[model samples]
Target: MDEDDVSVLVASLLRGDRRALARLITLVENRPRLRDRIMSLIYPYTGNAYVIGITGSPGSGKSTLVDKLTGELRTRGKTVGIIAIDPTSPFTGGAILGDRIRMLSKSTDEGVFIRSMSTRGSLGGLSRAAYDAIALLDAFGKDFVIVETVGTGQAEVDIVDAAYTSIVVVTPDMGDEIQAIKAGILEIADIFVVNKADLENVEATVMALQMMLDLSDKGDWRPPIIKTVATKGVGIKELLDAIERHRAYICETDRIEKMHYKRSKVRILEIVRSKLMDKLIRELENSGELDRIVKCVVEKKMDPYSAADEILRKLDKK
Candidate 1:
């Protein structure tokens, strides 16, 4: 029924209907429809807006940095879309980190649209709803979309992969920060930033980052580390310029092709996994086979892998 509703919903979105946009995202996030079919219908209108992903450890001033950037972008006359992803509280199943403060604190700015999102049970610590939100913003014709993640752990790495230019925010006295840099964020960093530059040990933090960058032996496209006290708006423009330079390079070389190809593969896998899992569960319940499979796997009578294979085989018919 939701799949039947999707085409009309998406068409209404294209006509600037906010309700349709909200409903479409809800359907996708809930997997309440033939989501892949709906997504395919909407695909051509996506990918026009720039996605800037800001991620870093907690207490790294990520929210502050994003707030400052929002001001600068508005000053430049861009219609901005902000999606601040806060971790959902497991007990309440709601966003507990209070993201709207940074977004809504910018009163009197009508050109900007600010919305806070919860991770909504995504183990990756991002949201399955995030992609749909981005698409809605893009279709709404925003010049730029800023996605700020609650940078807790490995999920910080996933944020950059979704962004056109990944920015890793850092601060002084972070113990595990250096190790996280190597795990993949360094490789994804189109630009690195050491926030809270006025703090003590600022230079030491910069040096430590430089040492790590040196160890990477990255090619000609070395990601520069910019220092910023975002609350004071220091060094924001330079960081923006660095992002521009990287954008130029990505445009000039084969990076666009490769990036899109990789994005396509990732999107395909995500769509398939979401759609197929939903379909399998529904079909199994309808046939009363889910309990049988669960019993087989739980009783030590069947391995989990074999049980999964059996389900996939059955779902293949649908």
Candidate 2:
């Protein structure tokens, strides 16, 4: 599509055309050249939606929970946008669980927009395009935006930086899964959900999470542990209430302002780092400097660190 077409589509999106919004997301995801322009156009319109990040191990019922939450939000007259990040196929670069076959019920709802994104081999358990996608959804005027990250272990805590509220879901009989939680996931959660609560040992799982929470010092806010059966929609209302309460607490205590400042600082640094790397690589490739450095390193004429330093020096000169 040309510039005129893109502008028309952006206008349509701002007018609440879901199809136009989908097309704009696709354009931003596939075309790097259009991302900055599109984000610049939409930046001012964002920050209105409440962003929620949900993450857990595979088969922890995150999709079902999100589906139920969307229903609850819609009943309250709120529009929703969901971004489910699925693992990417190493060979195909497509989502292994793309389209979330189980969420068909919400697909036709005009007020709810669902998108499935491949992690695309990003080790952070989020797609690089996830931030841009959230911005688009917020700018499109969704009252709530939920980002369900790739099923992750303890190390993939990037969601904490991306969302206003971060929920970590676990299940009964987790056995070793509890250790994974304690390793790093515990520090990032603002709420914990013991999903599949009907199963045996549910109390033990809840107890374990509560015990961990007790040991931590979160100032005036304590992360609530809610029991839920996503498949049956049991305790969903309570879960929603917990989310709202946390949001209210954060607002009352001014934690929201601190989060906004942190997010802005992190995002700007990320953009600068990415842009500098791209510029340096392109310049080196075009000038044959990259090949020369590679040859020198291969022939033992210069060490890798020295080669990198030479590149940086050249970059500084330019």
lDDT tens digits, residues 1-318, model 1? 656677788789788776676676667677744556667777788778888998887768887887788788888887777887776667743434553453355545765666677786676746667877787778867788888876766567777667888898888767566675565667767788999898888888888888888888678888899999988999998888887788888888898879889987987788688667777788788888989989998999999999989987875675
Model 2 scores worst on lDDT over the 10 consecutive residues at 92-101
TM for candidate 2 is 0.94
TM per candidate:
0.86, 0.94
Could you tell me which residue pairs clash in candidate 1? none
Note each model's CA RMSD in angstroms.
Answer: 3.1, 1.9
| TM-score of candidate 1 to 2 decimals | 0.86
Question: For residue 273, what is the lDDT in candidate 2?
Answer: 77
lDDT of each prediction vs. the true structure?
Answer: 0.77, 0.83
- Model 2, 20-107: lDDT tens digits are 8998888888877777778777788899999999988877888899999888889989999998876666774443464464553788
lDDT over C-alpha atoms for residue 27 of model 1: 71
